[model samples]
Target: MTWTCTECEFAANEDGQDACVACGSERPEEEQETAAEAAENGDDSAPEVVVIELPAKEKLGVKLMPPKDGVIDHGLAIDNINNPLLENKVQAGDLIVAIGGQNVDGMGFSGAIDLIRKMPRPLAISFEIDEVRRQEVVREKFQQNKDNDLDTQLTTYAVVFDNGPMGLNLEEAVRYGIDGAVVRALKGQAKTSGMISIGDIVYKVNETDVLCMPYLEVMNVLRNATAPKTLQFVPKEKLADVQRVNSRHSESFRLRESTSHVKQKLMNNPRLVKDDGNEGDDTQSIAQLIMDNKASPNVTAEYLLELRVDDRRMVMACTSESDKK
Candidate 1:
């Protein structure tokens, strides 16, 4: 009879041969077939292997310096320690060893002082000094272990200019009953200049009063207000010329001049008088008027003031005494 070993595919005559010539297996054909089937089905395969890779170890030279017994002054600047580290030719990965009480003599290393104060010790300390390199290492370690699809929430707010006009048109400005002013007093005129160059207040809009509102809020109201608005505000002192120029071209020129002059006269009066149940006749002091009326306190007042001073300085520096007008 012919016999074939299924395990090794070895064939031989079964005439007195109990084992296959190639495999040396004495198993019967049926057993050999079963073993071969188990191998094919992976039932007899080797177990899966797992490998973990650790970060490469680099030797950092660390020496424990004896703690200084005396208290260090706490006021010692970080520059003192940082400068020393730089001077000693300490590389990024070098370790700094510090010893002393909670405070370094009173002034130990800033980093060490912080750590010791937070932790209870006989503090024996060992740490790498590679600030930049250590941070990179830590970041890389966490990044590798992080999951791919993580959800994160982010919130943002608009950057608002504190004192600038936030882009308002005439219609919107009028609809919100927005009021603003320009003042001549802010311009430092000796008399009514009539040129309303800067510093004016808008005391009211469409006869509605506004004295306590912030400048930006007033602008926002105007920019968002409905069309065809009337803005009424007080002019600063020494700005009669500017007021005339502004009023001349204005649609309500006649009414504005008459009302403004009346308001001015009323303001000049020492005794306050109520007109038509309105307190103080809708008039404001020159300083209050300028603060309330200017487009931007930062730009119109602050920036202009600084620029004027700088210009005067530059002129004084360049001009001879006769040239100064």
Candidate 2:
């Protein structure tokens, strides 16, 4: 006889199986009956199903990944930054088992996403309370804490500048509800000699952590600090791949930003096919090749020649402007 899951109403349970395949609920005892049978027999022993309604227009705010081999639960939460799931105490790496009171087992990645989009406003999301996943999350958090502790010990670069105008361009950024400043540009002495990078995050001013202070307050502190003020900076978080430097600061140009585009352009041309051996060394070797005006199998000499021509034109323009005076 087929058994219906009390939790998600999945009715495809096979005989001899101890759990509902669609919802993972345990099989009912032989003495008990399905919900319909129980109603006919006037039995109230079956568990009550609870449905949760979410706030209006609120989303689950998670990125889901496909399940691994033999995994039977719903999609996995891989990214949950500023997620509404956090408000409900749902964490990244948790298994999303249900949506809108329906079990999500057997649904592939595309099916799960489609269901989420079709779900009513203020979507109801449920997670599987698996002990194994819970323990794994605990261990991951422990490791993250350890990694953060190590990061705290790393040396933070300090930039010392005189009082007037600071000579450093600063911009505010917020992440995970923490406020911090980013180095946008370097001016005057800061541009010529400062060790602080354009993309680094302002960790501290003097001895105060910028993240602890309000964004406006941090700006005010930098604006009103005494002469010979110290600003400590650290690299931004790993996930923050933004490059702040613009064309004026080509000295700080990063190959990472254009790596894919450059590869695509090279790949589009049959004659400029990239060398397989140098694919992994693209960033390092490309920089050296551009500097030397040399071409590898993947890079064309015309590209290097164009760069040289641009440099020459810039030099000629500068010389002509000097002559005009």
Separate clash counts for every candidate: 40, 0
Backbone clashes (count) for model 1: 40
Candidate 1 TM-score, C-alpha based: 0.16
Per-residue lDDT tens digits for candidate 2, residues 1-325, read 3356677776434344576555677877752445446667875443222223456776656666666753446444544436654555555556666666456776676777777777677665555434456568778878887756654654567778775666778765432223457778888767766476776777678877664454578898876677788877776552122222211122322456448777556445545323344666444433344534533222111211112454232111112333333
Q: What TM-score quantifies how close candidate 2 is to the native fold?
A: 0.32
Scored by lDDT, model 2 comes in at 0.55
lDDT tens string, model 1, 183-274? Answer: 32331221232333234445444434433354455656555544445544443442343333332233421234457767666567656532
Best by lDDT: 2
Task: Kindly report which residue pairs in candidate 2 clash with one another.
Answer: none
- The segments of candidate 1 whose C-alpha lies over 4 angstroms from its true place after superposition are 1-197, 238-325
